[model samples]
Target: MNLAENTLANADFMIEEIKKKLRMATGSALKATKLNDEQYEDLKDIYEMVAGKTQFSISEIEAITTELGRLRKA
Candidate 1:
């Protein structure tokens, strides 16, 4: 759970945590394996932002989901 490392496992951890914290309705669509490793830093940024807060506006969730979508592997 040492997310400071940029490993695939860390990416998976961050993705799962983000999904849980966001209570994403389409969580299944955002699996860690589907994400691009090159975008790990971006994902980490999102994860940190999400983790620091307990609440989110509808628009904020949508925006984060969208950003995650953009980071998905093609």
Candidate 2:
């Protein structure tokens, strides 16, 4: 009920909201992309690389996206 407690609670609520929005957006993006099974793991790896400390350039992103386009379902 104190100031710090209230601030932490608000931050937690905001983070949960952010997580929900992120999931929704990501799901929509995946559906739109229509990624194949082979691309699923590649996309997850790319997501982790982007989320983590790895800094990717616009060219790298373009290359990854292009690679995903090349994947076809068996």
Candidate 3:
């Protein structure tokens, strides 16, 4: 494949990895917190930020990481 294709493939791989992490974290957090409204809202926001309304992108993954950092501090 060409350079652009290679880069896109790598990005896709990373996005999938991030999605897995998000799924596990969100599920564990919800289970531990018992799906409280606040926690659910947080997870929903994270999911939306990471995955967007229709699709996931590299920028959205970066935004998700940034939001996770903020959440960690809070």
Candidate 4:
């Protein structure tokens, strides 16, 4: 997937990757459809940050998840 393009497929890819990297227990709740075009860049930024790291502290995971929550569509 060419994530450089801001498409929904790319967004879905990033969201799934982020969930795996973070080992999010509630990942199912964070669906790609919940992400909108307005939040794509923010999600991309989060995805990049998560991708660059191999491990995360509980606090870091919480913070990242919280940020994602803020970006989710209501």
Top candidate by TM-score: 4
Cα lDDT tens digits, model 1, 1-73, are 6877788788878888898898866666666666565687788899999999989999998899888877863
* Candidate 4 backbone collisions, by pair: none
Return the top candidate by lDDT.
Answer: 4
Clashes per candidate, residues 3 or more apart or on different chains: 0, 0, 0, 0
Q: How does model 4 fare in lDDT?
A: 0.84
lDDT of 4 at 49: 97
lDDT of 3 by residue, 26-63 (tens): 42221322333453356455544555355556776567
Q: What is the C-alpha lDDT of each candidate?
A: 0.81, 0.42, 0.45, 0.84
Tens digits of per-residue lDDT for model 2, 1-74: 23123243433333333335334233222232344444455544544454463445667656655553454232
Candidate 2: what lDDT? 0.42
Ranking the candidates on lDDT from highest down gives: 4, 1, 3, 2
- As for model 4, its CA RMSD to the true structure in angstroms is 1.5
For model 2 the local lDDT of residue 40 reads 51
RMSD of model 1 against the true structure: 1.8
Question: Each prediction's TM-score against the native?
Answer: 0.82, 0.37, 0.38, 0.86
Q: What global local distance difference test value does model 3 have? A: 0.45
**Candidate 2 lDDT score at position 49:** 53
Off by over 4 Å in 3: 1-40, 48-55
